[model samples]
Target: MIGMYDDVVLSFSESKAEEAGMARSMTAFGRCSDIVGGKSITVELKSVNNRFLDCNSRVPRAYGAVEERIKPYLQSRGVVRGKVDVFVSVIRIDGGETELALDGEYLRRYIELLRQMRDEYGLRDDISVMTVAANRDIFTETESGATEQDTEDIMSVISRAVDTFIAMRIAEGENICRDLCKKLEHLGALVGEIEREEPRMNEAYRARLEAKLRAVLEGRGAGAPDEARIITECAIFADKVAVDEETVRLRSHLDAFGAALSSDDAVGRRLDFLVQEIGREINTIGSKVSDVHMTDTVVEMKSELERIREQVQNLE
Candidate 1:
């Protein structure tokens, strides 16, 4: 039930349809707050597109230790490429009052070491309890450091916030995918128009060559022009301007672009490379084809390509 060219056309159409889903673009914001061990901790995540992952965080001094852990955790959670910023704030239910614990062992060891230093240097024995207590290292405050339970609770909230952020980014990426696919479809149609006009170019060149040959022969009083020679010259002109290779490569690039869009991996760099190839092929077509209609079509295709490039810039 299919014609000769139907299979090729259907294959092309199927490839286009396969490009409906992808997950490269990223731009989202999410915030979550929860109560843990009588403290309220809030986690905020904001992400935008970047070629590589660049994660930074702002957290309360007590939670500063988690800042180093957050980057690796986010990278594990599929944040492979972006400019992501995290903000964490903690509010204590006990009015921010810190409970300090004294380390008797460390205090005794430290004072003993100080006395040994003074004796060895033959210095004055003016060491007092007040002087020994001045060092903050002797006391450990509950609010200044995170316990194991606090770290666990913070991670829970962060995981939830990251889920929400990724969800938002995927939703926006789907919309962008649809827009880019539409533009690609339009570009393909333009290429088809050029293809249809391709055969006519040969015909036009042949006719012009024949006319010029006839005019020259008539002026020289020759009986007739060499028909075979005119045909050979026309063939050479057609070869000189042929765009078949460029069009075929352009179509291949389009298919690759679509496939990359629907892939699960980070494809921003791949898509950018494909875009350059597409643009190069289009430029080649523009240079070879001198027909006014084909030239106009090439111009429109370039405009559409530029729009797609702008959108691609936002991808991860």
Candidate 2:
């Protein structure tokens, strides 16, 4: 088994992920900080596996304009699919304060509803200001809107974090690729063993059948049976038990698995499809072959394939 961090090389404390391979099933944390408009801004990015891109952001209300921009930025940085959560926090160098406001319309509606209930159901009219204040939505905490310079500063920090994040995923992916390739090699060897045992199985079956027939004929005081009929029977039996088609398809599937692993795009689904096809071929070979040695080889191949499948699940 390849250790989780075996392929990653971390060079600095600021980067969550460094130079390495890629994997879809991974978690990475990234953080970056910089000065913008004489204020210190820090950005953090957290990524986890998902079938599609789902990006969310947490920033000061004033910088809400950047929330919609986070996903595109990540996508541009090679985040094709994942559940990525970004947090951007700004600290004014001079310790600036935030603004606040009340939603007067919402408050008025709440008060009117309370009064209506009090009149209709004979409820107490003691709805104090404190009671209404319990609805946090009555007040909004506002911050200064992010200027063009502030946006650039924030994106710069986030880009650095995204770079580290992608590096970690790639490192993990490389580890998975190495493990999967080994399993495939072992599987191919097992397939070769099965191929070797196939001819022996046919010969063994024919010899056993002929011996049984000869014994029955001799016990019945009969002469030697026709050789041609015996040959025909053996041929038919061999044809029925042949694994030519299965082996051919299995080999093709193995090649496809290799190609998928080497692809630059997201190959997780493709690899999964190939694994299923390979397993199917193995099962077919198991059912068609009767030799104990061949059965054992099939079992071994299945084991290797299952391991490969496990690793493929971690890829994208």
Q: List the residue pairs that clash in candidate 2.
A: 20-171, 21-170, 21-171, 22-169, 22-170, 22-173, 23-169
TM-score, one value per model:
0.75, 0.75
**Runs in model 2 with CA error above 4 Å?**
1-26, 101-140, 209-224
The true-versus-predicted C-alpha distance at residue 307 of model 2, in Å, is 2.2
Residues 1-316 of candidate 1: C-alpha lDDT, one tens digit per residue: 0111122221112213223334646688878888877788899999887778999898765666678789998777667888999998777775667767887899999999999999999989989989888998898655754677777778888877776676666666766777787788888888898889888875776677668777887899977677887788777877878888899998899888888777877788888899999999999989988778888999998999999898988777
- Clashes per prediction? 0, 7
Give candidate 1 regions above 4 Å deviation.
Answer: 1-21, 95-142, 213-224
Which numbered prediction scores highest in lDDT against the true structure? Answer: 1
| Local distance difference test values of all predictions, in order | 0.78, 0.75
